[model samples]
Target: MSTTAIGINAAIAVGAYFMTVRMIPRLRDMFIKANLAGRDLCKKDKPQIPESYGVLIGCVFLISMFLFIPIPFAFDEAAATDALTGGKPATFPHDKFVELIAALLSICCMIFLGFADDVLDLRWRHKLLLPTIATLPLLMVYYVNYNSTTVMMPNFARGVFGTSVNIGVLYYIFMGKLAVFCTNAINILAGINGLEVGQSLIIAASVTVFNFIELALGHQVESHQFSLHFMLPFLATSLALWKFNRYPSQVFVGDTYCYFAGMTFAVVGILGHFSKTLLLFFLPQILNFLYSTPQLFHFVPCPRHRLPKYDAKTDLLHISTTEFRLNELGKLGRLMVTLLRSMRLISWQELEDGRVITNNFTLINFVLFIFGPVHERVITQMLMGFQIICTLLALFIRYPLANYFYATET
Candidate 1:
């Protein structure tokens, strides 16, 4: 049954990939005709590219997933039940259908929100909180279907918090927070061609790899299978988008794609019962978010766009910076900035006056600061390489070092 399902999903994914590639060119004209376009600031001419093309990918993915609704049950019902329930007494798998519905609903809500944002250009504060509303359906489904809120404690901490800690309502709150974080993390880390779609691809591939491992080991097969159902088509459509959004980009993915990609990860992680493992794949994003905190929270002056500055003469991207007087910062803020500079996390030039010129806190800018000015494409590739490295490290920790930290039944 798993094999059959896998084959079907692969077919769907391939179809989605081809469909997206074929349709994107046609849609590009429509998007531009509708005035849905943006200037690619990294290029010298700042060419106008179709924007919000992520909505197209989202639409394709949703359609593919919707078409797959019947594949699990199309086979022998008893076999499907046994597979879904891990060989428990055979019965119809109503819960699986419910989960699918809820997942679709949540993803649909996110797509709508993302499209609205592209059209309306909502405030950053609003975008940050709107994802929570989109997650309500998912949380409700989780509570009603499989509310296992307890988390395993590390061996070192077990004595203090017990072997398993049931965080109760806090677990749901945490899930909500996770959704918010996932939705925003990709959006926050985005700039340059293909970076958003590129990072998402790496994370999705990492999650898919993790799912394959779990399924092969016969560990939580149903949960992992559930994750694959959404992830495969997502990866397919995203790959198609990346081909155009890559260096020398022909179209812009816009904030819509970021939100949709983030929501897809959140849905799979939450429902697949491997939220922790899923988070491991986002290590780079987490670091980026942490690094950007001061600017995000207004401790430092943040430009509307913290994108790496393009040096047209050199045809390279340099670290983008913000200038402010040192005296303007509160003592704590000043201390924090000084500490970051001292640690080389940030680079700054003390101006002739009391003002300070400091690099904007972003992973893209940080990469340029560390590696020196390079083409936009090089920086993106470097970050994607970092993402792959993080995934490998995460997998090693999850599989090998896990036993040393926590007792588990393999």
Candidate 2:
């Protein structure tokens, strides 16, 4: 096994061991407190430590160690960057070890941030800055090897779509911004149990599949083939996390786990030269964030401690009227009024109110996932057709449904 791989395996073991021994109990207490405040979704009648935690952690660590230990067995250590980049795969070496260290530092930063958020309620700006800072080292590594000649967009499309942009300083800035955006996207979804982890597993699996395809196509750069080595460890880790993370869970993955997990996935995607593919894989979550941007303003006026008022006349809830029954519009309207009367909107409350937007976001995402793989021309046509159908549905059905449930009853 390569020394670097062995060192990484050792690191994982040490880190996991220390975390399990020192952090788990404290985390459990934090979850308990959050549950008391109704902030924790996983604390509903669940055990303090779910059996899944032990199983998942054990399996993930063991597998990662096993896969990572024989790095020397896989590649030569003394090769140059040119040798590796020139399409000759070398054995696992110090460079990869450095990558793991970067990942570990990112994970450590995330953990610290999560702890602060949980205890002190850190603001959004801080959250943004932390991840950006954490990613600077990785960005420097990228800067050193970046290709200035690579076309970001086609020359012909420069006028219309602005595709002729070069990968310059602005490109790195945008990349950093994208990394932060993705980190928070995963964070926003962390409110629900198992949702973030499940979504991540799906993304990881998708990327792994893509990587294997590249490998199978004999797209080798040097002696090293495009392999699933990095992703496999992450996949194993996530699977282990999911054991305790599933619905009605015991232990929460916390922002510590969630943020770093997302960042790790993002870093791997960038390193593997599949950032666009990764974007496609998480397209649903990305769409969710896009749709929620507007609602941030709408929910801002609402107080933090109370639920925000819903305007029955215009602001329609996505739920169907049939789901809540009263033959008369007045009675149903009264029920809706009563529900909103008890709710208030605060900064934290906006997070919950934002769920509706997130759901719609996911629905749009699902549509994209179903149709995203097709050629651009075909997708545009399909979207046009779908828009027409949606227009008709809204005009004929959804509008009436809203009128029935939300219109002022005389």
Candidate 3:
């Protein structure tokens, strides 16, 4: 029965992939006609491309899931028996279905908010809080379902906080913050062609692998199955989008894709009961966020767009820098800069006068700095490679090294 359901979902995913591909070009002109377009700033020609077309991906994904709603019931022999014999009517996974509906509602809200952001160009602070509103349905579902609020503690910390600590309301708070973080994480680490979509694809693929592993182990099969159902369609739509959004891109995914993609991962992670494991897959994004904290918090000057500086003459991208005067740095700021430079996390240059220039705090810029100037496509491939490496390390830590930290395999 599980195999049948998986086969059906796989078939639906294939259809969604083709649907996304076919609809993009047709919708491109419509998007442009609606004045939803942007120039590819990194390109030499700066071609005008349709933007905010991620609505197509979101719509197709939702429709695909809706079509799949009846598959599980069709395959459920117990439910079929119950219906015929008028036995227990509760044979169906009605609770799981409710959770699915709530998850879809939250995702739908995020898609609407993303499209609104694309159209209205929402402020940064507003974007930070917007995902919280979208996450309310998910939180409410979790509350009503009475999901576990206890978290496992490491062996070393067990002596201090016990083996597992239940934080109750704080767990919900953490989940809400997680939704906000996941929604914004992809948006902040983006620039260049394919980088956003590419990284997101890597994370989605990683999560899918994790789900499959858990399912195969017969560990929390239902949760992993739910995660897989959401991830397969998402992966299909994202892969289709990547084909057009790659280097020398024919279209831009815009902020809509970022929010939608982030929320997709968030939903699967939160509802799948593996939020902690999901975070392990986001190591790169977390590092990037930490690296950009000073700039993000306005301790240092930040530009509206900190994308790599494109050199049309060289036809390559180089590390973009932020200028700071010697006097502008407080003692702590100067110490932090020096520490980062020493750790080789950032490259710093001191001017003849009293000014300093350092590579902007972004994974993209850091890669460019480390590798020197390279073509946009090359840099994107490098970062994708980095993302893959990080995810692998995360899995290793989650499975193998986890035994050392916890009393048992986590």
Q: What is the C-alpha lDDT of each candidate?
A: 0.89, 0.48, 0.87
Per-residue accuracy of model 1 over 158-254 as CA lDDT, tens digit each: 8799888888998899889889999899998997999999999999999999989988899888788889988899999999999999999998888
TM-score of decoy 3: 0.95
Model 1 regions lying over 4 Å from their true place: 76-91, 408-410
Tens-place lDDT per residue, model 3, 58-139, is: 9999999999888866777567767899877736677777888989988888888899999999999888899998898888
lDDT score, candidate 3, position 222: 71
Error of 1 at 112 (Å): 0.9
Q: What count of clashes does model 3 give? A: 0
Write down the TM-score of every candidate: 0.95, 0.57, 0.95
| Clashes found in each candidate (C-alpha, N, C closer than 3 A) | 0, 25, 0
Task: Please give me the total number of clashing residue pairs in predicted model 2.
Answer: 25
